[model samples]
Target: MADKNIADKNIKVTIMPLGIEVKATRGEKLINVAYGQGLDVNALCGGKGTCGKCRARVVKGGISEYTENEKKLLSEEEMQQGYVLLCQQEATGDLTIELDGLNNGQKEFVPDKGAYAENITGNDPIVTKTFHQLTFPTVNDQISDLNRIIGDVPGKVALDLRLLSRVPVILRDGEYRVTSAIFNDTIIALEAGNTTSQLYGIAFDIGTTSVAGYLVDLHSCKVLKTAFAANKQRVHGADVISRINYTIENPNGLSEMKELVINTLDEIISKLLAGSGIPPEHIYIITLVGNTVMSHLLLGVNPLGIAFSPFVPVFAESITAAVDFLGLKTLLPAARFILLPNIAGYVGSDTVGVMLATKIYELSGNWLAVDIGTNGEVVLAAENRLLTCSTAAGPAFEGASISQGMRAEPGAIYKVAINDDVDIAVVGDQEPRGICGSGLVDAVSELVRLGVVRKNGRINSPKDCPMELPEKVRNRIKTRGNGLNTFVLVEGKNEVAITQKDISELQLAKGAIRAGVEILLDEAGIAELDGILLAGAFGSHLRPESLKGIGMLPDIDVTRIRPVGNAAGSGAIMALQSKEQLQIACDLPKRTEHIELSLHKKFQRQFVRGMSF
Candidate 1:
């Protein structure tokens, strides 16, 4: 070793990754030095070395001090490779170090509302079946009707029994030419000659736990029909995290979930295609958006690494694949496939789809877009900077958990209003069968509004709150050793009850959303926001005033609050119509900045605080 005096001298260091170059006088702590250099090495445990995400690889000069905590978190191989805990190692001389991918990793999607309308069609791609005249068959050369049809179309064509049996009569009454109507590639109706009719297009929002599809005319984007159904992945796990965990735990769980979702999608595709009278192969294009997990599952990709430490997603850019590649038949073999761009591992393409549709990203004022579903993805941006994070908000609102909770399906309590006397107004204007997510929000909001629940989210009304032997609801509430109360949201005479386990689930969910927003704001150094835009079917129907009254929304200008419906689907549709939009989706990953919330203490503290009523 050289003279001790020289070793202890203040070391001038530069960290280039953050565009930060700062001097750390000798004896300064490593973490402080890193922070001073504008390098965000998250120390969730206040630099106690509890979390290991802040590992740094010393590229040049050695560190003077290395603590045991560094050794505990780093492998011998990594330690030998010059990796040091940024919180534990201090610079002794001129130094260059390799920071984690956080600084150089792919950027996230900034909220862009204007880009959402890029290339959406105004009409549906499906056409309703109708008839036209064809010349009656004559014996003059009496070519077979099948041969004539094969001759008209360039490609080899097959006939369904439904169409085959009608051919004789159709040819006998009409001429050689015919108008054919095909349902999902299966001929459903056949008449005479070329008839131009308005076509329809179907847009689908394939959520992880839920799937909603809309039927629209190809000529005009007017929505003609809509349908919703469960995601079918619940049988494997309720949330993405749990499902990922299950996949990690089981050998074939991931593949099973993937197959299940694809099958479900195929069935829906067939039903919708048939209902709209469009041949599956004839569908010119389909636009879809969902969370990373859902999209991964839909594409049959392994998602095991996304749930673990040093969290990373397999893909962040938008994807385009053949509908047939997904094992789902479509109307157009040549129809374009579009998937929305994802911001990060947690903030998915659905968020992009929503943001694209809302044009919130393009607004001049700073805006926040929160998609509150299985994952509470929050996007905040102003000027040129954008930040995003996702909270693991559970499935309580969607009626996945809770004793009496059900999905926002028929007979599910979707809305609720309570008076001082506790008289309730149920959705569908009928006796409440079970509460859906909206109803749950209404229940919690009403409870807070009526002083039945504390600001901290603790239930205050044990006697007045509907408890006791509904036998159905009571049996569902799960009990723990601590005696913390949970109520069932749904019960069935023959099915498992949605129990109180769901309430804790909801709290966790909402808390995560709150935490993600707080963490993003903290990272961006923003103390106040100009506006918050809720994007989704759920967000559109929610009462923002009540959401705020219950402390779910941040205090902001209420006038700024707005809803941009189905932004994700809209984004996908835009991509379907324009190559420019597709390029934007591809370029988005490079401009986004992802702030890891779990690495920061502020996120945890804020999450805990936001867990209240």
Candidate 2:
């Protein structure tokens, strides 16, 4: 309590280890203040204090007294150590806090679209430019400019009212030689000279955490350049529900969120053109796919409908719009945007893209395709019919909720094994910073195999060790005076360890995923038949065996567990290049039945069962 004057009462909160500082007001939540300053704290539940995602250790100065939320979320020892949920704690005065490594700004490694580029070949593009030598208007054959341009176009072509005004000058400038991009039976552009071969389409995967954009030449179906960036709308929240709450609560928040994503897309466009030397006008088409909320946000639609019970989406069908509507600059005046159709209230166009890329909808035998992110989508298909469900796994796997968790960056521990001795494989062979999702899976699996953790996911103390373990293993399992147990994976300057609370977090996450899969399988009326395709950024590095051991995935043949990298993006790429592939994406959502796992009777039972290792 330094001062009563507003001018003199600036609370400076310093977050250490990163050496970041932010200005705060007294009585303001630490999470809200940090989030308002664009700091990345784990507010996956939108500062509601239910997720227990954002915890800070107050190194100096005073913080508000802990509430029941903090008491239930944080350990008593942690409370004694000045650790409190940033969402639950408020600023009392200037404070300095030490923070654990939270964000994983790792460069994702998704394969090029050429992996299945051939599958979508031979189909005509929805938009194609053809060079035609139009007969110039003569006195005897005086036809309107629009008619003259469409005479040699083979079939009937509708011209935009805006393009009709400039048709005369464009044709004269080209000396009766002009190229027109045909969208179905409509002529959208009238460009002078032959530029038919320079067509490009952008395939975008709008993930909750990040966005992946691919600039592809539709003529060759070749991916020219790729761009990746964190999603700008994450400031509102980590998941769609949080974003929905943001939109419903704040005025003009919808427009702001929409602009944020659009700006990101524009930046990606700028980057793609800058890196590949592709002319802006040459990029004419855009195919965007994401969850229902992201798709709605891109179109400036309020997504609160999908955030509550009896979830309903504004639009699940495919949509086509003018590129300029998104406030983006393009080289071609005829550029258009195509949003891939969404599946359900929760299952969105990204899943449609995944199905198109993997051809899972057309495949026979029992097949399960899962796209993991903040929200996990699982599809169980058996050729004729498919059952799909969305699992709220939170952001734990992406390294948000855990204390020593991080993204798969250079210094991250990506692989771990505890045999006679503990072995760690870092991402870039650098010093261990923190464990990533894959590392967590491997560590948990190894611990189970070594009998260090029980089947019910209990970490046994050294005195209660069931088997004689290596001294290194025994030393790592420590019980603090507060009676809380934790296992240290790496003991160094930046110590990396997993607490008992972390295990519970992981159990909740993996349990949700496992239960969702079981429900879909039960609905599909299949036990063990065919394969499981893990599709997304996290799946590429995940070990199927580890996923099985931790009960995140079913115990299936490792060979059947195929990691189809960025299938959603690849499907968008396919849709970008071929009208037939685009149709496949459009027709998918109607046939699949979306299940609500929370409303299911056996969900709680399965969730509890799956929580055990």
Best by lDDT: 2
| Candidate 2 lDDT over residue span 202-264, tens digit each | 989988877888888778777888888767786666778788888998899899899989877
Clash totals, every prediction? 71, 4
Q: Please give the range of 10 consecutive residues that has the lowest summed lDDT in model 2.
A: 105-114
User: Candidate 1 lDDT, tens digit per residue, 566-599?
Assistant: 6776666654444566556556656667777778
Best by TM-score: 2
Regions of candidate 1 where Cα sits further than 4 Å from its true position: 1-201, 215-224, 249-252, 330-334, 427-430, 461-505
